[model samples]
Target: MCRGLDSLPITCLERAKELRALFGSFLQKSDHNLKKSEKLKLSDVKELLQWKESFDHLLSSQNGLCLFRAFLVSEFSEENIAFYLACEDYRATKASKLAPKAEKIYKEFIDSDAPREVNLDYATKAVTKENMEQPSQSCFDEAQAKIYILMEKDCYPRFLKSSMYLELTRKTRTG
Candidate 1:
């Protein structure tokens, strides 16, 4: 697929939409393969990340956000896990119909005190200059920051300490 907007064919973009409609359930079935479209929403990011943990560390992998944010961000700079902030810029955002649900999950994640933190780096950065001022770090700290910091580190101690190579699972059945 042509990654560049200039060289991208109209059909390819359209096909992506078609595929989302076609295999959406299957894609949604696996947290690793996010169901994204012309735009990536905060709700989508949070939901995808939640699924990632359930899918046995699949979503927690390298530049996983980059896989999506890579397209949304300029030039797809090899960083995938930078997305999933769970909250986008509040100022210019059109107010996602899904924001309430996403917000609820964000609150729950914070309240539950999940072991890892998700990052707001990508979602907040997606805000266009014309859109809004940056959200406070507190908003991110509550939403998704700490875990993202670790996800960015890429090489965690657990993966290093484990002498056994447990086969990773990609699909989420517990859901």
Candidate 2:
């Protein structure tokens, strides 16, 4: 909790936009029609708490998640909210959605010296200055699709947690 805009930097804003898109895409992909009033407190769920903690941990820098909290946490992106729900859809419904793409990417990058363990990590953080310079809708779509393909086989509990998150997304939007 760092509140207020004074602590946020311009570059962090840009990254927050990326994270917003990512979270939004996940919310957009949800198959169920949910409302913002739905209660989905994640504080009590150990696994989800871990994931959220890890996600929050990723943004330790100055105002790392301010925009995400303001934009994504408050309300859905309105336009692409549907797309964000897709993340859970394919994950819950499709069995092998995320595996193929991840396998392909891992194979592609396995021989080469990639810094991260998986392709999503490499893909999530677009490294080039050109990528960092401007936001690309295509990149977000591609990332969303690839992740969907990779996570389609997650367990039922995981999918349920994701679904709860979708409900949370809608709550965040209207509340």
Candidate 3:
């Protein structure tokens, strides 16, 4: 899991701010005709526009997933996506490795003191803890669903409205 900006050293934070400003400026200038190398293909524009159709569409596209994860990081809610992705990966784990994998996920996301703890309700956490007693592919299903819904309803809307997203879509449309 990535550390929050507040945890970064002052120099690192300054550099991050600089990068953000540079990126913002670049986006602002995107309306100007770009060199061919810098232009997004029509297909890319279509693909990016698809992300706005639904949260599932965003998650299904690799570029959309990266952009969404970055948006979540900016909002300091990246752990939600991290936990959701972890559960997706866990579901494919071999049965022989389920116990250890499940325990790792529980400790990292479900435990109260976990560094990247997700915002699960008490009941969901309890159910997940109980599920850990006999680790299986479905053990994290409930918690994952809760986090997914939370992101879809909350973060996804904000992301759609974010300057980064708006600028990209706007640029793509007119470029």
Candidate 4:
């Protein structure tokens, strides 16, 4: 079973609480005096409502992604999103830098002893390790896809039902 916020170390739990408060304050801001760019675009109810349409919609919005990342942290599953973002960044790396970048990603998120190692099937881990030998842009594609699916199918739904999400939507509606 996945560990929840209750299982997090006190420091982690405190950080999660801080993030939640930060996010809540962002949502509660009513000041219109700020410049257009200074205000979070997600303050718009329409934009926040769009998050319910699809996972891609939520991820596409910078604010939405930030909130979702915070939610993942609270769940102690932030590594999934971290790995996904790292792979996305890795794919854009210059060819000359691919090997070193790939090595860094593997060591950080794929190796058995990695500090933030992501859950993966034995076969997937072996395939990813093999792909590391060549260090192509596609080296992490399979593993990234697996993590993406896991998040979309598992985490995303729970996120939609989370109190933080519900409260934000409700506040947007009633505020």
Q: Write the per-residue lDDT of candidate 1 for residues 20-41, one digit (tens) a residue.
A: 3433344344455545652253
RMSD of each: 17.2, 16.3, 4.9, 5.1
lDDT of 4 by residue, 1-175 (tens): 3345443346645654664565466657665654576375455556668889998998887667767877897788988888898999999999999999999999988999987889899999999999999999999999999999999999999999999889878776554
The C-alpha TM-scores of every prediction are: 0.25, 0.21, 0.80, 0.77
State candidate 1's TM-score.
Answer: 0.25
Model 4: CA > 4 A from native? 1-43
The number of clashing residue pairs in each candidate reads 9, 24, 0, 0
- What lDDT does the true structure give each of the candidates? 0.35, 0.37, 0.80, 0.81
| Strongest candidate by TM-score | 3
Better of 2 and 3 by lDDT: 3
Candidate 3 lDDT score relative to the true structure: 0.80
lDDT of 2 by residue, 31-115 (tens): 3554443224222122223434444331232232343333432332211212333333434534334444333333332223432
Runs of candidate 1 with Cα error greater than 4 angstroms are 1-94, 112-143, 151-155, 164-175
Q: Which candidate, 2 or 4, would have the higher lDDT against the true structure? A: 4
| Candidate 3 Cα misplacement greater than 4 A, ranges | 5-40
TM-score quality measure for candidate 2? 0.21
Worst 10 residues of 2 by lDDT: 73-82
Residue 65, candidate 1: Cα error in Å is 9.8
